[model samples]
Target: MATHFEHLHAVSASQAYKATFASHEHTPSSSIKVQCPIEVSFSDDTQTQLAYFLRLLKQASQQSRWVTFIGHEALVDKNLLQSAGIDLNKVLVVCNKKGHSVQELMIQALQSGNSSAVIVTGDILDFTSGAIRDAAILSESFAFVINRQAKQQMTIH
Candidate 1:
């Protein structure tokens, strides 16, 4: 699968560290000092894109802090989440209502300093992504955005 993962961390990883998932090598979580937003663009299907999110959600759920997911209400499945080793009690799904954008809610959640991580799925404009990044930095937390692949040459619009 082709996965375009961006800005997952604020700094580069040590050369010695590695992870098994993709061609990308990741440092150990213990070694990571700065948290940031992760933007994922999958060149595969939605199923593959969701797998990337599932892996992240599972890791975030292990923390004692709250793990929040903004929007994607139609896709959240109890059985799937439970089966993925994600603790339901630690998870909170926020649906978009009351006329607020999903990314806006995500920024709020990240800056709140209450959750270990905030996740959402959609195309994120660079400015909004930067805001989310800054918010995550302030709160010392993680933010994630998962985007499905589009036909033709893809741009993060």
Candidate 2:
């Protein structure tokens, strides 16, 4: 199954894995999990998607959970998230490219064992199935934004 963001033209992390799988033409023998962008970016929107994300984070923070942010876009997201009343330190920003970033950041986050949620760019192929599985296993909750090419690759896989 696909995610809501896919329909909205927003990127999801699973899309990256799907792209990797399709590029290899590997038959998907395992299931994948991905979460869509809670808010989409738009130049004309009355409010910024980032603002919405912040609002969500503020609400989520009432529960007092640690949140992690992954991806280049996450840099901006983290900044906005902090503005919405989340502790700036509570949000972790990942700076690596997809193929290399996910595994490393995931490992660090999992090892830290303090993160309550994660927001990452869609780069599924960056991590082995095992690593992805591990993240799925380890994170209490996670959000992924799948990029456009990921699904095309997945179908090819």
Candidate 3:
């Protein structure tokens, strides 16, 4: 059977594993008890990244759970999402502000039991290692942190 992680379009197995394992050191006898949240970074590929994000969000919403979208104002385009077949009703976009803490909001959203998946877009660097680990352990829901930047190496020379 395919795991929940397998349903994601943008996140690879190695990326997921690294994001999860980067939090702590594990011995040979140690085992991972909880699923690790994924971090996807996009540079100069907003369209492609958004497409993948929407696809993953759609898949997650299949479980009939709300999907929380935390992103900058420019990151989320309602029209794009609509055209991509995303159900607008299932999404709640949280706009990041100057004083507000995105990480804290993410943790609260995950622990609230209302959201099945949390999709965060912006700078991936803002999400610290501790925050990701804490969010992963606190909830069974899937978490994804997306970074939007200009892709520096898209051309093949």
Per-model TM-score, in order, reads 0.63, 0.44, 0.59
lDDT of 1 by residue, 60-135 (tens): 6777777888876423478877998889999887877788877788888877877776867665453245787778
Candidate 2, residues 8-46: lDDT per residue as tens digits?
323323343343245435643132233222222322332
Q: Could you tell me the TM-score of candidate 3?
A: 0.59
- Arranged by TM-score, best first: 1, 3, 2
Off by over 4 Å in 1: 1-36, 41-52, 126-128, 148-157
Best-matching candidate per lDDT:
1
lDDT of each: 0.57, 0.45, 0.56
- Deviating ranges (above 4 Å) for candidate 3: 1-34, 44-50, 71-75, 96-98, 151-157
Deviation of model 2 at 4, angstroms: 12
> What's the residue-level lDDT of 121 in candidate 1?
66
Cα RMSD of all models vs. native, in order, equals 7.3, 12.3, 8.7
| Candidate 2 runs further than 4 Å off | 1-39, 45-48, 77-79, 97-113, 122-138, 144-157
Taking the tens digit of each residue's C-alpha lDDT, what string does model 3 give over 1-157? Answer: 1133433333432444433344454211122223555655444444355445565555556556677887653234678667767677887877766566777777777877777678775555565455565655566566777654433333322
Clashing pairs in 3: 43-149, 43-150, 43-151, 44-149, 44-150, 44-151
